[model samples]
Target: MDSGDVDFAHTDEAARKRRDKAVGLARYVWDRGIGGPELLALPDDRLRKLARAAGANPPSTRETWSVVAEMLDEKSRWAAVHPDDPRAVPAHADEKIMWVKPPLPPWPSR
Candidate 1:
């Protein structure tokens, strides 16, 4: 293959990796019940901050839902273009974002 072809392949793989990460993160936020009309009302700056805090690129559009949709759509497009590629959602994705509370200390022994 030509050097150009090799460069293109590397670029495509990087894009795929980025899309996969965004999709996982979007799902994590969705699982946490973090979206709705209230979030939509947030100013663009705040929305961008929230996205950044969630480890996502700041949305190009003002709507947070659009950010989630954009992330998901990119993954879907990749899957469509590479039908043989394994497209499984990462197992236990929520575990990455879960904030498990520490259990109370065992009751004092009598």
Candidate 2:
């Protein structure tokens, strides 16, 4: 195959990977009870931070994700519109949540 064709294949693979990651981040946030309205209100930077916080497992350096992924997620278009009163609500709700994790095996775990 020509060099151009090889480059296209690699580009396509990278695009697919990015798309999958964006979808995963969205689902993770939604499962955390953060939906469309709240999502739309957040700036891309804050949203990416939120996504990383909500990640099942996230990488360290690439915390903010890519512009391409943000665009695909429709977050790039969401400009950070500061609320008239930023302090209107508590950052965290008062409710308590119980999270469950699998029990550690008798054998050493990763």
Candidate 3:
């Protein structure tokens, strides 16, 4: 779908950056087969830091990461049905209607 096909408010730069980072982290861990209980057990601060490093707006509290997780799972399902439409994923958590491919940055190795 063309960018114009979706009608939604644009996300500000900072928020978009944050969302991108979060998505990247989620994608990275998922791609590495690192998730489920192990992921859920991560400390909120660690998750927040990872999200921040990934470019996502960090979750304000421990409970907030679940929102991103849910979004990721939903996007995965959506992609399964519409495999060709990767852009169907939302660009920001606050604006689910507006869609964009979540940026996937290279993981930072220590």
The candidate that achieves the highest TM-score relative to the unseen native structure: 3
Model 2 stretches with alpha carbons more than 4 Å out: 1-10, 56-110
Query: Per-residue CA lDDT of candidate 1, range 1-110, in tens?
Result: 77556654247775575566556556655444333333455567765665676777764544335556565555556646886754534334454333322348999998
By lDDT, the better pick of 1 and 2 is 1
Task: After the best TM-score superposition of candidate 3, give how far the Cα of residue 49 lies from its true spot, in angstroms.
Answer: 2.2
Clashing pairs in 2: none
Instruction: Show where candidate 1 strays beyond 4 Å.
Output: 1-25, 67-110
lDDT for 6 in candidate 1 is 61
Candidate 1, position 101, lDDT: 26
Candidate 3 wrongly placed segments (more than 4 Å): 1-41, 86-110
Estimate TM-scores for all models: 0.35, 0.38, 0.39
Order the candidate numbers by TM-score, best to worst.
3, 2, 1
Q: Looking at model 3, which ten-residue stretch has the lowest summed lDDT? A: 93-102
Q: How would you encode candidate 2's per-residue C-alpha lDDT over 4-101 as one tens digit per residue?
A: 56654247676676566667765455344343544455565665566556663442324224432454245323323323443322233221121212
